[model samples]
Target: MWKTMILLVLVNVINGQCSCSKFTDESSCFAYGYCLFVNGVCVEQKCEAIPYQEKCKSPLCLWKDNKCLTFKAAESTCQTLLPQQCTEYQGCYYDYTNLKCQISNNCSKLEIDQCNGQLGNGNSCIVDPFNNKCQEMTDCKSLSTEFMCLSQFPFCLYQNSSCKPSSCNEINDSVSCSIMDQCQWNNNKCEIKNCQSIKFGYQCNGKTCGFDKDQCFSCIEQYGYQFFAGLISLLFIL
Candidate 1:
C-alpha cells in the first residue's frame, strides 16, 4: 500500500499539477501551466475557452500571425481577409482608429476633414450633416449640456472655459450636470448623486427628502432664519 501511494505521488508530479508553494518566482509556476502571477506568488486560474468570432466581437477581428490574434486590425486587412473567410457575411472592418478596434465603416476621411477643416483654418470644424460641409466648432459655453458639447466637440468646458473631464474638486452646477448626469458637485468635488426628481430649492444628494412643505419648513427652521429663509420662501408656495 505504501509503494502504491508513492507511485501515485510521483505520477501527480509528472503531470505538472503539483503545488507551487515550493517555488518563489512566476517562471517556475508558468513552466507547470499556471497562468496567474499575483502578489509575489503564482496560482492556477480557470480560463473558459470561447469561440474566436464571438470573443473578438465588432471592430475586433481575428488574424493569423501564428495562431489566431484578436484586436483591431487595419481597414485594408480587415475588409480583405474577413470577407473571404465567410461568404455569407458582408465582411467585417475595424470601426475605429487609434487604439480601439471596433467593427464599422471607414469614416477616417470625413473625420479628418471635420477636425482640420477643409479650408485650412486653425478653428476646429465638423461635418454639418444637413449641408454635408465642414462647419466651425461651437464652444461648450454656447451649448446647454455637457453631452451636447462633447457630442459636438471632443471635450467639454470647465468653470473657466477650460476643456477637461470632471476631476476632483470641481463645482457641480448646470454646466457640470450637462456633462455627466450621474455626478453632482458635493464637498468641493464632483460626486455621484441622485438628482432625479429634485424638489425645488432643496439640495439634491443621495437621500430623498419629503416633498411636504410643512415638514421641510420645520426642518429648515432648525437651521435658523438666515440660513434657510430664502429656500423656505421659494418652496413653500407649493
Candidate 2:
C-alpha cells in the first residue's frame, strides 16, 4: 500500500511538472515561474519569464508594462515615442528644439550632409537661388533652370525648357543611369537601386547613398511608393 502511494505521488509530480498548458487560471499560471498566461492560455515562458524590465534584453523582445514582449516592427510608429526613446528605434529622430520624436519632413532644416537623408520619403534638399538657403524640393516643375533639373536627374528631367517628373524606366541609356543618383542599369533597363548594391566606396554618392567601412548604405528604407504619391499630391496642394 505504501509502495502504491509513493508511485501515485511520483506520477502526480511528473504530470504537474510537464502540464503548463493544462493551467486555465491566471493565478495558477503566474505561480509557475516557467509558465506564461497569454491569449487566454498558459504556455512555457521564454523571454516573458524575465522578472525585471531592465533584465529583459534581446533583439527579438521589447520591454513594455514591466514585461518582455515580442518585437514587431510593423506595429511600431515614430509618432508614439518619447524624445529619449526616439533615436533608439529605426527611422525615428529626436528634434531637440521641438522636443519631439518624429520622422523629419522639413528638408530646409537639414544641413548639406543631412539633406539627402529625406530622399526615401520623396524630399530632397536644393539650394534656393532666390534666398540662398537649402530648401526642400518636392516638385520638378518648381525647378526654374535646366542645371537645377539635371542635378536632380532620374527624379526630374529637363525637357522643352521645363522640368518634369522622370521615372527610372524613362531613361534609355545605361551611362546616364550609372552616373545618376538613384538609378542603376540592370537587365538592359534603368532601375531604382538601393545603396547595398554599390560595391565601391567611391560609388557611394552622399546625396542618395552613404558609405561606411567600404560598403554603401542608404539613410532610410522605411518609405515607399505611397510616400512619393503623397509628395506629388502635397506639391499640387501647395
Candidate 3:
C-alpha cells in the first residue's frame, strides 16, 4: 500500500512541473519561439512590457529633425535660429503662437545673422526693412535679404540712411536694389557700390587713370544700378 502511495505522489509532482514546462534542448527550443524546458520544467526569459516615456517618441520613426528634444537641447537649437527668445518642450520644436511643442515645424531658418551691426555677434536678428524694425524669426525658411524697392516721404533719412524719392500721393513707390550688398545711399539718392564693384565703380575709365563717372555710368548701364540706376534693365539680360 505504501509503495502504491509513493508512485501516485511522484506522478502528481511530474504533472505539476510539466504544466508550466518549456523546451530546454535545442530541438525543443525550435518548437517554441525561444523557450527552454529542462527536466520537464520551463526555463526561459520571461516576457515583460517596457514602460513608455512621454518625453520621447519611439526610436523607430527616425529623426527627420531632432527638434523633439530636452529643454537644454531645445534652448540650444532655438538660439541658433532665434537669438531673442526660445521656449522649450518635448516631442517638437518651439512654437511662437502657442508657445508649446505640438508637431515638427520643419524649421525654416531665417536670419542666420552674425549680428555684426546692431543684432550683436553670434546672434541672429530678423530684419523687417519695410517697417524699419527688427524681429527674430525662428523655424523659418532660409534667411534671405529681400531687395524690393519701397517709396518714401521726402527729406527723411531712411533707416538705411538713404533719401527716398518724394511722392505726392499717399501710396509710396520706393524700389530697392535686387542686389542688397551693392546698394547704398550716395548724396540723396540710392547708389550701387561695394567691394566687389567699388574698384570698378570708382574708376569708369579704369584704375590705370584716375576715377571717372561718365565711363563708370556707361559700364553701370551693363550692370544694374540703384535709384535712377544705369540702363542695363532697358537692354541686357545676361
Candidate 4:
C-alpha cells in the first residue's frame, strides 16, 4: 500500500512536468507540447486570458464601438458622465479605432431654444448637444440645420439659426433700408442718399450741443473793455 501511494505521487509529478500546452505561434514547436515551466523548461501551458471591455449603449444606437480600448483613451474621446457607475449610457458604443460616437439612428437632437434670430441669423430648433454650451450648426452661412452633425451621432440641430441672403434673381427683393439709410426706388433703381452727418459736443443744452464760438468771443471782448475802463478811472482818481 505504501509503494502504491509513492507510485501515484510519482505519476502526478511527471504529469505536471509533461502537461499538454497551447500557444500563439505553432511554428515555434518548442513552446507547444510541454507545460509552461515556472523554474522548469520554458513552455506555455495555456494562453493568457485577454481582458474584455464592458459594452456601452445609447437610445439611438445600441452597442457602439465594441473594440478593446484603454479607459483613459476611451474616456478622452467618449463623453460618459458616469464612467465608474454602471449606467444606461455605459452601454452606448464608443469606437476607439476611429474615435467616433456610434449609436442608433433613432437618436434625435433636442431643442435647446426656440428658433429665433438671437443667434444673429434666423432658423429654428438651435440646440445644445450633450448639455454642453456648444451649439451645433447645419451651416451658419446657409443656415441649414441638416448639415450640422455631431461626433456622437446622437444629437443634431433641426434647422439653421440665422437668416441668409437669397440666391434667386427672378424677383425684386426689398433690402433693408437701414443699411444705406434713405432709399429711393425709382425705375427699379434703388438710390440711397448720403449725408455728411454731424455730432454735437458736450455742453449742448437739451436740443443743442457744442461750444458757441460767437457767444464766447463776445464775452471775452466785454471783459477786456471793463478792464480798460477800470484802469482809466484809477488814473483820474490819482
Best by TM-score: 2
- C-alpha lDDT values of all predictions: 0.37, 0.59, 0.30, 0.29
Q: Which stretches of candidate 4 lie above 4 Å from their native place?
A: 1-113, 117-142, 145-187, 191-193, 196-238
RMSD of each: 23.4, 22.0, 33.1, 39.6
Across residues 38-142, which tens digit of lDDT does each residue of candidate 1 receive? 677755443222223333222233434433343333344445453324211222322234422222322233443323221122233344444444344444454
TM-scores, one per candidate: 0.25, 0.31, 0.19, 0.16
Arrange candidates by TM-score, descending.
Answer: 2, 1, 3, 4
List pairs with backbone clashes in candidate 1.
58-103, 59-101, 59-102, 59-103, 95-102, 146-178
Question: How should the candidates be ordered by lDDT, best one leading?
Answer: 2, 1, 3, 4
Quality of model 3 by C-alpha lDDT:
0.30
> Where is model 2 more than 4 Å wrong at Cα?
1-105, 110-114, 119-122, 129-131, 167-170, 175-238
Candidate 4 lDDT over 56-113, as tens digits, reads 2221122325543322213333354333221223223333354443321111232232
Residues 125-151, candidate 2: write the lDDT tens digits.
Answer: 575555555566767988777777888
Q: Model 1, which residues run further than 4 Å from truth? A: 1-72, 80-108, 111-148, 152-155, 158-162, 171-238
**Clashes per candidate (backbone, < 3 Å):** 6, 0, 15, 18
Clashes of 4: 18
Better of 3 and 4 by lDDT: 3
